[model samples]
Target: MDEHKSLADNMDEFRKLIQDLKSMSITMVDEDQAVILLNSLPKSYANFIDTLKYSRQTLKLEEIKSAINAKNIENKASGKSDADGLMVRGRSDKRQWKRNGNGLGLRTRD
Candidate 1:
């Protein structure tokens, strides 16, 4: 029927419109824009960035492990034990903190 054909045509057009809209909506950020966004962050975030930079260059395995242990112990003391019931776990251990990138921090695994 003509009605069925028209409906299919309309649906195809709608799908194409959606695809176009999605493609148009996403915009890539240039390096300068990224820098500006980073600059606009809070002082604490800036300090964190500095810490990360310093840590990447100067932190040793012992220092990173110590920090991870300290954070884990603190979390346990605060009653936030991880899945393996571990308070302090290391990178090469069975009960390790789920690492995000190369940062030294603790995160709960649910």
Candidate 2:
């Protein structure tokens, strides 16, 4: 799944599928599973996916799953957690403002 360059959580799902497959005689069709795996990929892979799709490449599930896991691990090691990362989005924390005796503007705690 990772070698297919899928996401970590998505790869986990594939791992689960393989485990579950051992118990059941019936299994999901490889191509459908491949597409499902592809759908789990991030937008950065859009062109790659389109190329693969147009080129009619048959994706190997196990390899893709492995690749995804490795990439996710690499990302985890290199990146910061959401809370620790830069806050470039959404509403910021509210700040309390107060007026001072001098008639000039001032910021104060609530």
Candidate 3:
């Protein structure tokens, strides 16, 4: 649950902890596990957490895992780094240019 760690790494650590607890006769329900995972998310995941929390009546651990994996893939694809939590996006198309009243060139909005 470290903010500096990636989601996959955190989940792996969580799974190991759960396995250790199981060996000690401690167990948690799927919903509780899901809730713990959700609660462990970093502040950067606030929006995602809210959406998942309010959009479901019952939480499924498998579904949450799948969603997290998909989001991780999406973040990677969109030039976001998990450890740094940085995302960069920009338009690749040509921008229009126009001359302002002051005779200076300015980029026009699409």
Candidate 4:
């Protein structure tokens, strides 16, 4: 019975030591170290999401252009030509469409 009690106490101490070591290991891993580890990952995997986003955006742009061209062709085929009238007006018209910089100000230059 005494030997069993000693073994149980040793096991408890060993478990506590393991827990302390695990906590210390976590504490040693700082934010910068974590960021460095993330950055060190393979470039292909890191850029995977960005690559898919860019490809989807490009595909959408191409689709929009094709739609616009198809509409223009349909109008032309129907003998309804107003190409010159569709051209954008002068700079004054564009001035009103100026982007409101959301209070960031006109010049973001440092």
* TM-scores for every candidate against the unseen true structure: 0.25, 0.43, 0.72, 0.22
- Segments in model 2 whose C-alpha atoms lie over 4 Å from true places: 1-10, 17-25, 41-56, 80-86, 89-110
RMSD of each: 24.4, 7.5, 7.5, 28.3
Q: Lowest-lDDT window of 10 residues in candidate 1?
A: 1-10
What Cα-based lDDT does every candidate model obtain? 0.44, 0.60, 0.85, 0.40
Q: Is candidate 2 or candidate 4 better by lDDT?
A: 2
In candidate 2, residue 4 scores what lDDT? 42
lDDT of 4 by residue, 32-75 (tens): 33233223323322343244335552334234334434644665
Arrange candidates, best lDDT first.
3, 2, 1, 4
Counting only residues 3 or more apart in sequence or on different chains, how many pairs clash (N, Cα, C under 3 Å) in candidate 1? 0
Give the winner by lDDT: 3 or 4.
Answer: 3
User: Model 2: what TM-score?
Assistant: 0.43
lDDT (10s digit) by residue, model 2, range 77-106: 978321233357864666666768888778
Q: Compared with the true structure, what per-residue lDDT tens digits does model 3 show for residues 1-110?
A: 79888788899998998899999999899999998988987777778888888899999998888887887798789887665455699988778899999999999777
Model 4 off-target regions past 4 Å?
1-59, 83-110
Cα lDDT of candidate 2 equals 0.60
User: Candidate 1, which segments miss by more than 4 Å at Cα?
Assistant: 1-56, 83-110
